[model samples]
Target: MTGPRGRVFRTVSELGIHYRRSPACGVGSRSPRKGPRAGDRLPDLPRGLQARSSGPGWHLLVSGPPELWPDERIALVLRGRDDLVGVHRLGGESPWPDVVQGLVRSDGCLGFVARGADLEGLRAYLERWLPAQHG
Candidate 1:
């Protein structure tokens, strides 16, 4: 498949290569265990969440308790960002074990993962990857 930049990708996995970052880049570490990681296709979300995950642009999935979710400040920072499709709150039964937050690419690949309430990490990842929308 050819991407918007006219780069030819031989497979669906290759489609997200542009979004992948090395561990040194501070996105997420590639682990030997089986689980979500940067560049890995996002695992199946719950039926309800899957329906909402569809659309253009990136999607933010926040799990864990409400207190751990991104606060108003983060929300304000993300406001008006055209690259962001929407934010969906995942329930405790989410497939991604021990993950508190995840950034899902438009092509259904996991671009970033946060295991803790690392709002700063999320902010940084977005800043480095997605372009900010200017008025």
Candidate 2:
């Protein structure tokens, strides 16, 4: 895909997950300290989702069965889940995340974010929100 500036962006999608390149870990807060700071290694990334170094920040990627629709907008659902986000803790910090960016692909890339919902629910949710790729 091409960016607004006409810069060609590489698309990463496999299984049932989609990937989008983000500047940093934080989606809303401008303050870097509140989220995954630059150069910080993501702790306990979800099994289905992944983040890799994208130039200065990271490229959040979702992987799953190829049948999964490649919906770039699906990443937006990651907001407001502070429990799953990784931050630089001083001491006595819980390593587990309640919600983080990424999702468990149908192929089993389990992510750190625990939606508390089952896989069937997730599939239904996706079907309701995004259009089918094969249909």
Could you say which candidate leads in lDDT? Answer: 1
For candidate 1, lDDT tens digit of each residue in 46-71?
Answer: 54555577578888887767766655
Report the lDDT tens digits of candidate 2 across residue range 23-129.
Answer: 22122222112323222333333332233221222133323332332332343333332233222211212223222223333222322222222234333333443
Estimate every model's Cα lDDT from 0 to 1. 0.63, 0.29
* lDDT for residue 121 in candidate 1, whole number 0-100: 74
How much does each candidate deviate from the true structure in C-alpha RMSD? 7.6, 15.5
TM-score for each candidate, following the candidate numbering: 0.68, 0.21
Q: lDDT of candidate 2? A: 0.29
Span of 10 residues, lowest total lDDT, candidate 2: 23-32
Which parts of model 2 have CA positions greater than 4 angstroms off? 1-117
Cα deviation at 74, candidate 2, in Å, is: 16
Runs off by more than 4 Å, candidate 1: 1-34
Clashing pairs in 1: none
